[model samples]
Target: MMQTFLDLKAKQPEDLPSIIKIAFGLAAFFPPVKSEIRLDFFDDQLNEVQKEAVSFALEATDLALIHGPPGTGKTQTLIEIIRQLAARDLKILVCGPSNISVDNIADKLGPFRIPMVRIGHPARLLPSVISTSLDVAIKYSSGGMLVNDIRKEMDEKLNTSKKTRNGTERRKLWEDIRDLRKECKVRERRCTEDIVRASKVVLSTLHGAGGRDIIRQNFDVVIIDEAGQALEAQSLIPLVRGPSKCILAGDHLQLPPTIPRTDKTSSLRKLELSLFERIIKLHGPLIKRTLSVQYRMHEMIMKYPSIGLYDSLLLADVSVRSHLLSDLPNVIKTDETQEPLVFWDTNPHGGFGEDDTGAHESKSNAMEAALCRYHLRNLLEAGVQPKDIAIITPYNAQVALLSGLIKSEFPDEFSEIEIGSVDGFQGREKEAILLSLVRSNEKKEVGFLADERRLNGICLLQNSHFLGTVP
Candidate 1:
């Protein structure tokens, strides 16, 4: 990828596109050149703000940003933008930081019947998305039939090589097998290029966009989801591909790029700031729009972060404002279980405190783990399905302890319950969430919880019920 950028940088200034020049800071400031084309709306259910975001994306000539907080239907809005862009006969390139993120956009694009293909290794993709991958597309193409025949011959030769006792015969079979494998590669490359050329939309992770197969293909527009979670260099791999327009959608307030603790160098620290965040800070409202309505969390559960993190701009949709676990037909709710927000305080003076005695310096509190288990049992016995609940903690030690405790306490019914750290649960949500804050000590340190982005993410990870264990 670095080589690709170096080659791009070596090109003459007049040969590069405007977007690439803007990305490299070689272009002067220019106002957005709005296109006057009429856009067709595929999904009429979009809110006013969502509709505005789509309109801005289609109109902007150089760049656009969609600031989507948690549960604001960012993916839905991006889908609409792609649909509209496709209707205009524009070739689109959609990307994200991870395979799952790209797969999510591909899955949602299925119903629209768009000519789309995902590029990545099959092992990294979800099972549901493999059918739409470039490999699968090649397998079903006319060129793929030739590749398959060559592969079958290679396999037959391999079998013969293994069975033969004579060294000369085995050597001959191995040579033939090697030649057939080379032929397969040549044919597969042709198939890949053909499939990519025929598709209108290409989906991939940020790094996957730099693959040798599709690196030469030009796109009219590039849309990257979860942009704030990717490093600036990673995002630039797709942005420098000569697209006339680029749209980035993500929440700077959620999670930033994950940098290893050992990467303490000044250069690496600067790289931790994502392109989405840097652009937003520099441009602000000039090229950005925020989606204010969220349909995931209940109003009460969203109130704190909406006020503190989002300047009270985030709102709960009417359908989910009063939603609760007790509203379910079979749920047996007590006073504690009925509220949207519940705190179970474990006061250290009362003998419940965190300790790292057996956790290798990772904090763990036995009392908090037990309390999490008790709440899990109550939610399960009250008719909440195990699949609908998630156990979240700030420390891996606490996660391991909670998982062991739950498995032992409910040996037969603990398989579906999800237990993970906050980082692992960044883009996930559940009907009910149980959070364990496992830092209670003499100095009153909160560790990583002091990062406001982590706290903002935890506060918005639930739909109806939130049970937090504070020390």
Candidate 2:
């Protein structure tokens, strides 16, 4: 694919979009081109910054960026941009760094009545988006119905072939089945192509965008969500399709693209820098807009990170200023002050000391695991549903320990709660988060916890309350 892009650039530069040329350093980077097009706002609930982002996305001719702080309604703003672009009859391709990110955008757009289709394996898709997946969409198309009919006939023939006694008759049946299967394959491909051509929007993960079905289609606009988490090369896969306009939205302050720890080469280190971050650094405010107001975290929970990470620019909406677990009816307060943020010291003298002895060199503290289980039981007993809570740790060993502890204690009741690494919880939110910072020793070495980006992700994983077991 990279070779193809290079070939096009060398021989057919005019056919390539300006955005692609600028990204590859083939052309001088220019500021956003102002458009005379005026659009009526589709969503009245948009904040002033969100509205500005939507307008800037529409006006920028080559490239645009949106720096969405945690819970600032970045996905909502992206949906409006897509809607307005589609209103102008432009075909748009929406790509994300991961499957969950793409599904999130699709889930929100599902209610907008847009003709969009998600491209990826059905099994990887969330349940809410399965209905809009390529396979499901094809199944309901006219051609899909034809393929189903052929498949039904093939199934009947195979069943008969299995029961037939005569060898000649059975061979004939098998041959007929083979021919029917071939026909089904041809029809399914055509059906897939038809769906891709008719849809106004195509959604896929960055690598999935390179699939043959999507590569053949043209997009007028390309929008990448969570762009800060995608590698530069990964982000280019969809942009190489020659979209005239491009928009990248994500919080560069959060977790960056995961680079293997063993890869200390300078080249690999450079690749860790995402395209979204690179562009903003090179162009400053000219090509980007920051979404200043957040709607997800409580004010008290949002206070520290807002001042520390966002330079005091992030603000919690009035509706969630005092959001707390105790505010829910029949819930028990875990602390007298009912503070949204609570820290339990897990040092050697405090709660529990960390150890890698039985964890295969990955960090895990039994004391923290036991504390996490205690908190889960408290929330469940106080009326919090298992689905509204999540446990986040920075190590896989700690994740496994927490899962085992939760299962042994509740068995079936707490099975719905999610337990995973901080990286796994990006672009996700829950009512409450139980964090285990599994690092403690005599020297007080912090290890990978020193990555501020990872800490940024940990800070945004909860909506109302946060509980941490710190070393």
Candidate 3:
């Protein structure tokens, strides 16, 4: 076999399959595999918390919640646990409540031998299954269906496609068909089953896949990253899938379930309580738990958000091991006012007379432009790589604006820099983070999870002194 293989390799330049195999392998090289998907891991290598979570999760058929303070390596520990399980030959499915979460996990676990699935938008979940099964040629990028919402969206798209186009112009009619019209004949476009059945690892957002019958049967373990950001009811719906063992990881202080701040009183808060509280709610005692200790934040920057929620975790101690080399790389907002903030109002009624269209673009651009200038100068002064800096926003509109600004301004300086949202920025850090208050409301409202409400708060409530944090 060795001699035959050596002969094949010697003729690779002229041979069809040999050359192709070498090219393909070279393209990927080895990537960081999602550790959870791998079967074997050095259990002794994991910290005490990671080892406990892994042992308990595999043993308990119910659930294991790995909650912790911000900056702790909870996600990393889950990945390692998965790797250990893979070593033991257990198949696992990793998912999140959002697309960004799915993507982040997929990127981390790509090299493993596990089959994979990523469900985000309400339209893509079912369609993804359908495409993989039929071995359909159609591929979806974004603006697609999610697992739960796919049925309705599919019907809507189906109805939209049947409409008569007698009077429509050629270009208009062509564009409509190209985009799948209102009906996205997804079943007809691709192989749905093959995609889902072929992989051992599936990554999906929490918002769309819950209560869906298909996801329940495909994998053994379901891990929810950033568990706090999901509604209490949301987590409940997912556990029913095949009576699977659940693992939840999140830094609750940074953010909570998608529920409104006011809505924080009931289910979400109850769901978020430590395992002891949840155990009381269940028929028996709490299942199992884990806590990660590593900190990736600069000590100074950690002081702000850390002073509040993470104090009890001993994260405040500078003596604790940390991943960051510098604390507060750029501007330190010692005095809230000293913080360079750009607040823009797009609502016409807000003090700034709005031309809705350009105003959003303007506000987004100005704030990002300001932030970029800051990171560019500071990073170069400190001699850090341009890729090390990032600009994160609260919503997609700002991501688009800042993305555009970066392309237009320092296209060369930050060609690879990424723009992210609050959710996407979790478990990650950069030299600086410029948060944009895109939403406004007239009065203090407790909980409104959707972006529209947030927008209302930022655009309508236009009063800065409301939060009391602002003087």
Candidate 4:
């Protein structure tokens, strides 16, 4: 095995691609193989069916969707694509509905040497790779960032207190307040650093962005994992930004965003009267791609969902078989007491269900209450950990009493309550999910979720608008 630089140089041209791939993975640094590389998927041993699906995605012009049941290796398939593309030196931007997805990708992209840069925020890692900028890394990442402006406000309020309480108790309280203020400032700094320098593959809570914005940031390729659970509108924001290639991944059968509303209308429906009233924006065919062969689930479980794209059922007798619906009861239920799941995607409507109005409906709320009890009690009987169970509701006020009821009956079995609709559950996983459809009379309330002017939306819209109207 005598080999010299000259010998290596003389190697076959075909072997060059192989050597380059190996070096790219091992090298400390190297130039990109192509000016840019965008591939919908990357896998060597895909079955003929899966390969065809991946091809459909790559050939698409506007958007590509890859979907299936959970734990079907959808995430891993994406990672495999990144690995293959990285071998060709592609620069990728990965964004998901939550930080968890972002972190998962980072972990798979292990040992990153160069820091991610130039997207949003300042240049520089808030925390060093080894240490998150203490002033950064993770903080009140939740909005309104929970800092005690109270401390500063209190200090201002007491400025006129010339006769300070002379008691030691008063002195101690003042000192404690000062300490608390110091802590808040310190933690705020950490949170800032966390968000700023976390990584280029940011896992953010999709707080209203558009496709045009993502492309504007110069992403050569973008992969949105869990795309179906997202509204076609929200997910398309990144596409509008103009990434040369984009992949939308998620099961369309899952949840989408929730637009708030109340009294007589839902948040999204109210918004439709306001924003989309002008023109509806992004849709999937407008984009170009999709991945459909699910690698998880038994042969039977895959049969029902496949019926959407395929006419007949397909299953294998192999070990990694798809679990069919008829067999799912016994297959998915590993434990003897596994609970039942209730799901409703019914419509809300008027004029023969043509309109989607989320106004207080007796049927919707009643169904929600019943489904809530069914799933919560099922989990209780199954003895699933309380935190492992989640009942996702479409409204905030929608599930308070339901949660209270669950707490009353099976306080120890179903303690983790998630309210406020589908979007809120993004990037989270539960042993199982029982979705309560609050707006199914079929007007398509999902689209109105992105309208910018919906009052019943985020900030206390009603109070602010009606403040002066009150006596």
Per-model TM-score on C-alpha atoms:
0.91, 0.87, 0.51, 0.46
Which lDDT tens digits does candidate 2 get at residues 78-184?
Answer: 99999999899999999998899999999999998899999999999999999999999988889999999999999999999999999999999999999999999
Alpha carbon lDDT of each predicted model? 0.86, 0.85, 0.46, 0.42
- Which residue segments of model 3 deviate by more than 4 Å? 1-40, 43-45, 68-70, 84-91, 115-200, 207-220, 241-244, 259-290, 304-307, 314-378, 391-424, 433-471
Instruction: Show pairs that collide, candidate 2.
Output: none
Residue 186 of model 2, lDDT score: 87
What's the lDDT for residue 442 in model 2? 80
**Considering every candidate listed, which one attains the maximal TM-score?**
1
Per-prediction backbone clash count: 0, 0, 59, 53
Give one digit per residue, the lDDT tens place, for model 1 in 116-192: 89899888888888888998988888898889999999988999889999999988898998899888998888888
For model 3, how does the per-residue alpha-carbon lDDT over 144-232 read when each residue is reduced to its tens digit? 33332554554554565468465455445456555643345453222344454445555656544442423434556667776656654
**RMSD (CA, Å), each prediction:** 2.9, 3.5, 18.0, 16.7
List, residue by residue over 343-445, the lDDT tens digit for candidate 4.
Answer: 2333333222322233454223444455567655654554445554456554555466466666677665544654334445544554444544443343345
Give the Cα error of residue 237 in candidate 2, in Å: 0.7
> Rank order by lDDT, top first?
1, 2, 3, 4
Give me the runs in candidate 2 sitting further than 4 Å from their true place.
Answer: 1-17, 24-28, 33-38, 148-187, 263-267, 333-337, 349-351, 358-360, 377-385
